[model samples]
Target: MNILLWHVHGSWTTAFVQGPHTYLVPVTPDRGPDGRGRAETFTWPSSVREVTPAELAAAPVDLVVLQRPHEERLAAEWLGGRRPGRDVPAVYLEHNTPRGDVPDSRHPAADRPDLTLVHVTHFNRLFWDNGSTRTAVIEHGVVDPGHLYTGRLPRAAVVVNEPVRRRRYVGTDLLPGLSEAVPLDVFGMRTEGLAEELGLPADRCRSADLPQRQLHAAMAERRLYLHPVRWTSLGLSLLEAMHLGMPVVVLATTEAVEAVPAGTGVLSTRPEELARAARRYLADPEAAARDGARARQAALERYGLKRFLDDWERLITEVRS
Candidate 1:
């Protein structure tokens, strides 16, 4: 299938284009959001081709994969003003959990029978009111970073982009309290000033924005992975950490409770409880290794690249048919 999609979410797109299909990614001259084309940081196969707006208008697209609400309109404009899902088969992939009003969060594609809405998590599907539109939950699948856990650093590793801006939503506030029991090494974009903002010394809570490969290696060195995020969809970083064979300490919220199993690591609402668990993992390398093994196994079973590609293939066939 020839899939038309935008380069919206990097990690998710990285795993997606790996599937067996000719992915037509929109590319602008400036490589802006509307047309970022192919990813530079992550490697992509030749099957993933870049198409300009003018070129996309002429290309034969088997299916349109819409990530954002604006994409439907953009597709229409680019595809000779043809309505998506009506004139052309289309599927709306809902990446994030609904924001703003909780109970009354109406999906932008709600009640639209023209397009099938695909949610990334079951939690997202349940929370979102899709009206009469067809919906399906296809949980995340990650490209395996291999089992790289060393747990030699004796510190908790965290991955959250723009922690200062997102703050409580990303659970940046919880880090300070958790770091009291275990040191934290934060990795993500715009995380440079996190230590100063949290009033922690550089060593206690340091932050860096490394490339994905380097970030994975750095995270594996830490004693455990810390997922302080209280809300939002299941983070790909959590899955990446598990794939790297790092034991995790995650808040029991969103899809995390489903992802992290018992003996894999600790899952609790209380930051102190998670802190104590982090301390335990820091002290016991053997225990951390044992849990990390389980984490890796579970992640592979649930989020392996092959499984993800297969699921997408099936979905694309259905949508195209």
Candidate 2:
């Protein structure tokens, strides 16, 4: 199948294009958001091809995979007015928790009979009112970075983009108190200057923006992973951390409670409690390694690359048929 999708979420797309089907990604001169085309930081399979809007009009697309709301219109306009879910089969992959009104949030595809709505987490499936739109939950699948954890650094690793702007939503506010117990090293886009912004010493908390390969290596050295995101469908970074054989300390909110099972690490609603858990892991290398082993096992069982690709393939066949 020739699947059409944008390069919106890098980690998810990295896992997605590894499937059997040929992927058609849109590219522009500037490589703008709607048309970033191929990935640069993360490696992708050869099956993923980059094409311009003009080329897409003549291309044979089996199905269009919609991520952002504007993609619905953009796909149709670029594909010679072949409207998605009408001329071409389409599915809206919702990668976020509803933004407004909490549980009362209505999905953009709500009541749209033509397009099927797919969510990355079950938590998003329950919260977003899909109404008449067909819905499915495929969870998350990540390319395992293997069990590279050393736990040599007595600190916590966090991955969040633009943490200063997203702030509370991505759990930047919780880091200060948590850092008092265990130092934090944050990784992602625009993560530099986080320590200065938070008024913390360079040792207590520091940030760096590294490529996926380097980021994974850096994270593996940390004692534990910290997921402070207050609301999100699910973060690929948390799963990636587990795949790296690092124990985790996550806030028991949204889909995190389901992702981080007991014994894998600690899940708490309180910041102080999370701090204590981080301290325990930082002090005991053996205990951290034990929990990290369990974390790697659980991640393999649930979010392995093979399983994730298989699920997507099945959905593609169904949608195409």
Candidate 3:
């Protein structure tokens, strides 16, 4: 079957592509917001092509998976009219919180009969309704486990895709004080100017994407992973952190509250409370290791690629039917 997984967003489509059928991903020239085009270098087994409303409407695409609602509105006009399979069986995936530009209708992409609304986390599924029929809940997953495993490192780490200078909704802002209590390491593309605000010179923090192998090593070396996501859906980085046996410290917001069990880690929005929790783990390294072990066990049990693939296969099969 020819499955067209169209999402301006990247990095989250690995599971669907690992299936038994052919997979097609659209390529974008630039990776920025304007770079709506898919990447030509994508080496997924099935195929790659440029996606536009015209091609989407014309192709006998079996299943069209959307990562955002805006994609549906763009393709719908070209779909001629939405239908179950002929034009495409479309599924809209809500990957993050709806921002200021969009309203809070949970099923913002459900306007089309052919479109199935899917939420990345059950906690996020609450903000929408479908004639009392709730949207499907599929948690986002981490693809590479090799990067996360048992290791003995003393630092607390937060691996945001971008650098942290000032405290943002994510862990960057508060991490300094947390790090002051215990050493902290922040990694990703540099935040550039925020170092002054953060008061940590850029050099003190690693501000670049580590190569895959190095990244895993870095994750394992850390005993703690700070995930202070004030806004947005559950972060996959948290799951990756769990997989690596890094006991986590996350704010009890959105899905973070559910992802971290008491044994796995602590979830509190209060800085002092979080600081206390950090102190507990820092003071008792063995307890931190125990929590890290539990976290790894939990992640391997629930968020493995096989489990994610199985759930996605069921949905794709439903679309095909």
What is the C-alpha local distance difference test score of candidate 1? 0.91
Q: What would the per-residue lDDT of candidate 2 be over residues 229-290, giving only the tens digit for each residue?
A: 99876899999999999999999999988898889999999998899999999889999999
What overall lDDT goes with each candidate model?
0.91, 0.92, 0.66
TM-score of each: 0.98, 0.99, 0.82
Give me the displacement of residue 242 in model 2, in angstroms: 0.7
What residue runs in model 1 are displaced by over 4 Å at the alpha carbon?
A: none
Per-residue lDDT of model 1, residues 174-293, tens digit only: 988888989999999999899999899888999999987688899999989999998889999999999999999999999999999888999999888999899899889999999999
Q: Could you say which candidate leads in lDDT? A: 2
Residue 272 in model 2: lDDT:
88
83-135 per-residue lDDT for model 3 (tens digits): 53335676777777655543455355645565567888877677554334326
Q: Residue 207 error for model 1, in Å?
A: 0.6
